[model samples]
Target: MPSLVPHLAAVIFVSALAACGEPSSQAAKAGPPPRPVLVKTVAYADRVTERSLVGTIRPRVETDLGFRVAGKVARRLVGVGDVVRGGQQLASLDEVDLGLQTEQAEAEARAAAASLRQAEADLVRTESLTSKGYSASASLDRQQAVTEEARGRLLRAERAMTLARNARSYAVLTADADGVVTATSIEPGQVVTAGQAAIRLARTNEKEAVVSIPESLLSLAKGRAAMTLWSNPGTRYEAKLREFAPSADPATRTYLARFSIPAADETVQIGMTATVTIAVPDRERVARLPLSALFNQGTGPAVWTVGTEGRPTLKPVDVAAYEAVEVLIGSGVEDGDRVVALGVSKLDPGQIVRVIEALQF
Candidate 1:
């Protein structure tokens, strides 16, 4: 009876150990709990909106500086990025040709003056002889006509000499206003035609942002805008629409728009990149979500949507625009659809998840 009792006790202990081992194996097979993630219920609303576009800082008034006369360049007094004042000499032409022209004009004037003196002497002699009846009236009339012709020639020569002097002065190209040279197309010994662009000067006082907008977005760019330099984005400057292209570019189909910055800082230089943003009235409602909610599979942009069963289903979304803090979604998830707002990269399609917090708006 004592042996039978020990056997019964061993069987009971072994049964208890087997029961504990079976439950642990089943729990191990079940795996860990669902991963916790932050989620939000998507809802569409008509919100005031703005769009940002990249642009370049440029002068509102860009002038092409050129020589008034065609000649070989003697020297280029300024270079690209050189700050210049009004009436500053930018370049000079070889004065050899201009000098010869001036000398020739002077010589012609001297010859005309000598001819005028001779004609006057002849007219005076002829008048005296005619008064004493020693010369014919016809001869006096001829001398008078000769004297008038010589006077006309002298006047023409003087005017020609003045024009030659002016031409010589024109050989030295000067700035029309205070500006910075943005480009130089001519160098020493380079021959440039009259009115050919030798240097590109941009006025220093007026600054503008030049950007290209697609045809679809041209209507929104009419009113006031904002500008921020690429290097210094924190400092924003108020800008107004100055001008825009009436027609679109054939290749790009984009219209060029220029925005005038009211008071741009000195640090904003020409050719520097900038961003222009303009607000437009929203025509339709859209779902706004934090940027962290976006995920790009091989196909396109998507977001993890949590279903009632706590399973995450990746829903493809059409992103309308990306803002500083949020992304505007045009379509994809409907209203009241729960979407994972954070830690999207860690999730998988149809993976089980637990929402730690629901984000409002």
Candidate 2:
């Protein structure tokens, strides 16, 4: 009886081994379980980014005014921050010497005119005597030469007189355009040389906003921009790019940009602080998705889109640009498509997935 019981136990153990060796056909047919993934609905719209920089309002035309003739400054009619009109006197030089030179030239011109009249009278008498054969022809010829010489003297004197008067007028420095005097270097008795910068006038008609931008943002400065005065931030003025520095500034390593504000009014004064806003426009339509959603299997860039049937399908996408946290897709995905937002690498075609809806912006 003991031997029979041992044989029965051995048979049961053998049966258990056979059952364990059989293949798992059910698991092989069913495959892996559904993968859980986060999904976002695709939405297409313009993505505009705004950048701002501090700037200053400046006049388009700034000029330095100085005297044309050297002299002691007799009076300074305008000071810094003074408003001046075109042709308005700003300063005057001492006119004592200029007046004397003019008077001397006038006196010389008068004397020459008198000598010319006497020579002409003598020439007429000499010609009359020569015609009657009472005077030698040589005498008439000498008188005619004297009259011509007097006339030449008169012409030279007149030219000197004109120059003297011009010099006298140059003593007064006047504004050439309507502007505000931003600087003055001359006082009541300061001695200034000719063409020295005695005053600085900035034309108030045309105004511009000047700013400095780094090389990364050079394109923004060149493109469309707007500006608002610090004093009046509520009002915005459209700005047009008018000037740009071809090279970076030596110290700041930034390029200077100037934007013309055609709508600037009296409130926008020179030297007022302003902010220039550069809003880059959307050049084309594109869809933006998280970078994690991008899938690549050596073919190209793509994304895994989970369909309504809980299955994921790999779709090729044209990448317009790469951003800090997202990729701009030009095509291959339509609006309202359910796109896997994360863990796209582990996904395969024909694989079912569990969609965890994520907020889409």
Candidate 3:
């Protein structure tokens, strides 16, 4: 047992020396430090001359369908989404009261006509009697006055008959043009006043997109066709300036612009969001960049550009406009120069970085 202890001791001593001879424990624990991230230069794409805006899909011409005479809505011949043609009946007002009034007027007119004929006959008899020296001049004058009164009454009755006929015709609501019913405000048994909107019909041929243009850009939008880029790409539509509000909105200071679309797709429905673009002439060239590229320059506007050495360099910029997710660079950036689209605020001058193409917005 004593001999075995000596041999174990020698073995332990040798192992410790061998481990020390190989390397220090601290030295072996450490590994190489991480390598610096790489950055690359990219040539920017040329910016296009297209301008854009936000707009709404609307009918080119919307006609309100209403009754000319006030009455209870007896029958609604058409409802919302129904297509109607010119002269098509859309609704009817209760004609009972109108019919009664018309009948009364007709009766009055007939009575007046009868009275006029009787007066004329009496006048002729009196004239014959006066010529034969059987009637006095004063009696003849009285007969003439009666005839004039009857003629005046007849004329008034004729006018009343004409008015009654017009009122009756107004009970039937008809479409002035071919269109689809966009809204229905009245139902059966509901009373509507004259000229009240019962239905809103939109003309099928004349479709339009209404856009509120910023007053600042109104000068640029003049003489330009407002275009619509449909939600589905590859579908494009355009319209001329149909109308524009002469006054600016008090709240937003924007002008209302209506553009007429000659033909619209069947799938195009009202109230859908449409992107509008109007060209502006004689405007300065703008370099559009992702909003992320904008950086804070202390207090004023600023941006970060990827310098020739692929390093972030802060630059002060004047912005013409800030749109959806992009910034229109009025100054401080060239069209074909690359700018740090994102992570610009986190970068510093002379610091290297790694830029990758963004796949998602």
Candidates' lDDT values, in order?
0.91, 0.91, 0.78
In candidate 1, the residue pairs with backbone N, CA or C atoms under 3 Å apart (3 or more residues apart, or in different chains) clash, namely none
- Tens digits of per-residue lDDT, candidate 1, 1-361, equal 8779989999999999999899889989997789999998888988566779999998999999899899999999998889999999999999999999999999999999999999999999999999999999999999999999999999999999999999999999999999999999999999889999999999989999999999888776764589999899899999899888999989999999999998898989988999999977677789989999999978999999988899899889999888888999999999998889989999977678888666453
lDDT of 2: 0.91
lDDT per residue, candidate 2, 175-217, as tens digits?
A: 9999999998889888889899999999999999999999888
Ranking by lDDT: 2, 1, 3
Ranking by TM-score: 2, 1, 3
List all candidate RMSDs to the true structure: 9.1, 11.2, 10.7
Indicate which candidate wins on lDDT: 2
| Cand. 2 TM to true fold | 0.68
* Candidate 3, 138-237: lDDT as tens digits: 8999999999999999999999989998999899999999988999999999988888989999988667878888867776457566455566646777
Each candidate's clash count: 0, 0, 0
lDDT of 2 at 316: 97
Backbone clash pairs for candidate 2 read none
